[model samples]
Target: MRTTTAPGDALGVLETAALLRELTAGLISAADFDEALAQLVRTCRAAVPGVTWCSVTILQAGEPASVAASDEPIRALDDVQYGDDGPAITAIRERDPVFVPDLAGSGRWPRWTARALALGVHGVVSAPVDIDDQVIGSINLYARRPGAFRDRQQLTAMLLAEHAGLLLAAVRGRVRADRAQPQPVAPGDEEVVGHALGVIMTQRGCPAPEAREVLRGASRALSIPLAELARRLVDSVARHHPG
Candidate 1:
C-alpha cells in the first residue's frame, strides 16, 4: 500500500534465496490459506526495503477481498480495484501478472489512480497466485513513489507467488480433510498453539483465561480435537500479528 516515497533496488541471488528461506520457514506451522497469506504479506514487507506496507487480495468463488493488508489506505486501494473491472482484475481473471510502473499517471484503473493518489500511493506490482490458470488470489504491492518494483523484482515476486500457491494448496487440502473428520493434534501443536496464543495476547491484549477460552471456542466451533484446535487458533493469530 501507500507509504513514504522510495525507489526499488535490485536484489542479488543470495538475498533472494535468503528471502525465500525466511518466507518458507515463516509459514511452516501455518494452519491454513489465510494464515499463510498473512505471513506472505509480512514477509514481503520485511524483504522489500522500502515497502512500508503490504496487502493481499484473495479471490474466492469469484469475489475478491483483502485477506491481509498493512494499512487502511492500502486495503482500501485494493478493495477499489477488486470492486471494479480493471487491469488488476483483468490480470487476476486472466491469470497474468500486472505491473503498473506508474499508478497516478496510468489510466488503466482510472478510479484506482485517483484514490491511490489521494492516499499518496503511486505504483503497483501485482502477481497473481494461480493454480493452472485458475487464479485464487493476487499479491498487490503498492508504493508512495512511482515506478516501485522493477522487472527482475517482479520475477522474484512470481517466485513468492509460486510458493504461496503451493502453500495454500497444502493448507487448504488439510483444511478439507480436517473438515471431513475432526483433526487431532500432532506433536508440534504445542509450539504452534503457543505461538498463536502469544500473538493473540499481544494483539488483543487478552489475559490467559480469555486466550484459552478463545482456543476452546475455536476447537468446539471447528469440531477439531481440543489440542489441534488450540494449535490452529494460535497459528492463525500469529500469522496476522507477526509484528
Candidate 2:
C-alpha cells in the first residue's frame, strides 16, 4: 500500500452521508453477494468523480476472482492484475489502501503498470476489503489521467471498500442460513414481488406483466430464486426511501 501525506479538504458530512446512502441502498436491494458487489462497483464508478473504471476482486475458495467491473474493458485490466502483481493484489496483501497517482514512473509493478498504461489507465487506487482481520479482496479504481485520485478520492474509495467488507459479512451469514434450511417464499412475498415489478416497469417502461417477466428473466439469469430477488428489490427501495 502506497501512503501519502498531503493537505486537502475532507468530504463534507452531508456529502459523505449521501454517498453512503447510495451504497447502502445498493446493498439492501441486491439479491445476493455478487449483485451487492456489482452495485458497489457501479456506484463507485458513477459517484466518484474522475473514476474511469472500477472493479472488485474477491478470493473465491482461496483463488482470486474479479467479481464485478464497471465496464467490459475493465476485465482486461483486472486480468493483468491476476496474472502479475498489481495495486489490487498489493492492497490485499498489505491490508491497506494503495494509490498510484501516476503509473508512468512506477517501478513497483513494472509489467502490470505497463499494461495499464497501454490501456489508457493513468492512475489507480486499490483498497483492501478487510473483514474481521481477514483480507477478503480489494476494490480497484482506475482513471485516465494521472493524479486523478487525490486524498479525497482515495478516502472515498477506502470507505466504500470498508462497506464491501460489511456486505461480505452479511453474505456469509446468509450463506450459513441458506445451508441450514431452504427458504420458500411466503404469501407475503407476493407483495414484495409486486413492488419489484413496479420498479422494473418504471425502469424498463413496460407493463406490469412485462415487468414480472423481466424479474423472472433476471432471476433466471442470476440463478437467484424469484422470491429472493423480489425481496432484494423491495428492500433496496424501501431502505433507501423510508416513509
Q: Give the TM-score of candidate 1.
A: 0.67
TM-scores for every candidate against the unseen true structure: 0.67, 0.70
Residue 34 of model 2: what lDDT? 78
lDDT of each: 0.70, 0.80
**Residue 55 error for model 2, in Å?**
0.5
lDDT of 2 at 110: 89
| Cα error of candidate 1 at position 105, Å | 2.1
lDDT of 1 by residue, 49-97 (tens): 5455677777766766445888877776677776666545766777777
Model 1: ten consecutive residues of lowest lDDT? 1-10
Summarize candidate 2's per-residue lDDT along 23-131 as a digit string, tens digits.
8888767766778788888889998888999998877555774458887777777877777988888988788888877888688898888878888999998998864
Error of 1 at 98 (Å): 1.2
TM-score: model 2 vs. ground truth: 0.70
Give candidate 1 misplaced runs (Cα > 4 Å). 1-11, 131-135, 183-243
Runs off by more than 4 Å, candidate 2 = 1-8, 132-135, 183-243
